[model samples]
Target: MPEEIIDLNSIVSGRQPINSSETPKEVTFDRVHSILYGNSSTKLIYDNAQKYFTKKFDQTYPHTSLQRDLFISIIQKVHPSLKVQFVVEIGSFTGNSASIMGKVLKESYPGSFLLCIDTWLGDLAMWINKAVWEHLSVSEDGRPTVYYQFLTNIIKQNLTTMVLPASMTSIIGARFLQTYRFYPQVIYLDSAHEQGETLIELSLYWNLLRPGGILFGDDWGWSSVRCDLKKFSYMKNLTIEQAGNTWILKKPVN
Candidate 1:
């Protein structure tokens, strides 16, 4: 009897191929950075951020230690390569981290970009945390949102070209990309910190990540994150690499 060989390319496609550059590469960072800080001053965006926070929320700009550490850890993990990089960020809040990643893609990995997937609705944790809630904006009629602020941040830094936005749930976004056969070199998950949701997201995005690509994110200190990740790691038979509060998982190169 002859063995049947599978022809994967025979699968149905939803859309025509969209022209894009090749796969991913490495990164870097500096002061007054990531992207689109405008042309006036190096500190223009920072100043604007502070002013915006003070005027709107009556608080300081919210750059935290977790973000700083995440940036550094990502820089360390993604090596310098000439290949074009594709990144998908599942939870973009106010676009600070996305902008930082945009800069990394723009400067270090040329022709690269980051796509942000989020509903812009506050997660359960964010809804419960007062400090996080302070960052959310509401329409006069009463629709709470942080999406506009995220868009503004991306535009303010001129990162629109490098940082694309998709206002949707992570699962839906993942399935959409799967239809296009879109595979990112890096996938960062930071949505709802629930065990079930985290596990499901990790599995969904893991399939969309190209081999050797890294899936990492912050909130490693969250019990839900740690527990779900442990389950995910065990299931995938992949070791977890930790740097500060950031957790990393690399898809096998083969």
Candidate 2:
């Protein structure tokens, strides 16, 4: 009997061909690269931003360094040539992801822009979480300052020019885009995680995606997210690919 050995480097480079019976289970280099060095660049920006925000405003951000990197990777994959004009993010919590995307778009696609749609009112969970309320600034009338922090973060990143802030709920924002006939190359959904809301968002914004565009989201492991994505894929007859914790569905080109 001959010994069957797997060449690690060959697998990583996709150079060596595998026999049918010896086919590897997964051959996604993006996932592998993410596991190895995904945080290399984004982490620095996140850490610096975190320190600055904490020192200046005594505040902390919501999204993690991993999420920031993943978002960038998705944007890169969608616009490999850096020719995208518009990218939309459904939830722009604290503006971390939006700032990152804004920087990437500005550098890669000079005229590209990011449209972030969020009410900035911490979700139900955040509203109930005392920790969230403690870090938030209050207005003269006593309303928690969510949108202000988001704006401050964007400004800190110097992304005001590339990132457009749309202060509104997901549904209203999506409808506005639809009514305005705005089509984006990439649509990222990270807002409501509930199954029903997630499904609605998937449906509503899916249409706003240009043909051959990408509609991706985070929290793929969440039961609601996973189930809804599968159902949506089935309904649309599209295939879903998992990149890190994100699930992506590329619209068919007509």
TM-score, each model?
0.73, 0.71
lDDT of 1 by residue, 105-204 (tens): 6777666778788888867756777777767675666666576677667766777556766777998888667655667778888787788788778878
lDDT of each: 0.67, 0.66
Query: Where does the lowest 10-residue lDDT sum fall in candidate 2?
Result: 1-10
Residue 116's lDDT within candidate 1 is 84
Q: Indicate the residue-level lDDT of 155 in model 2.
A: 66
Q: Model 2 Cα RMSD, Å? A: 16.5
Where in model 2 is the C-alpha error above 4 Å?
A: 1-59, 65-69, 79-82, 133-142
Candidate 2 global TM-score: 0.71
Question: Model 2, range 60-143, lDDT digits (tens) per residue?
Answer: 665433355666666666634424677888887766667767777777776667878887766665667776655445466776
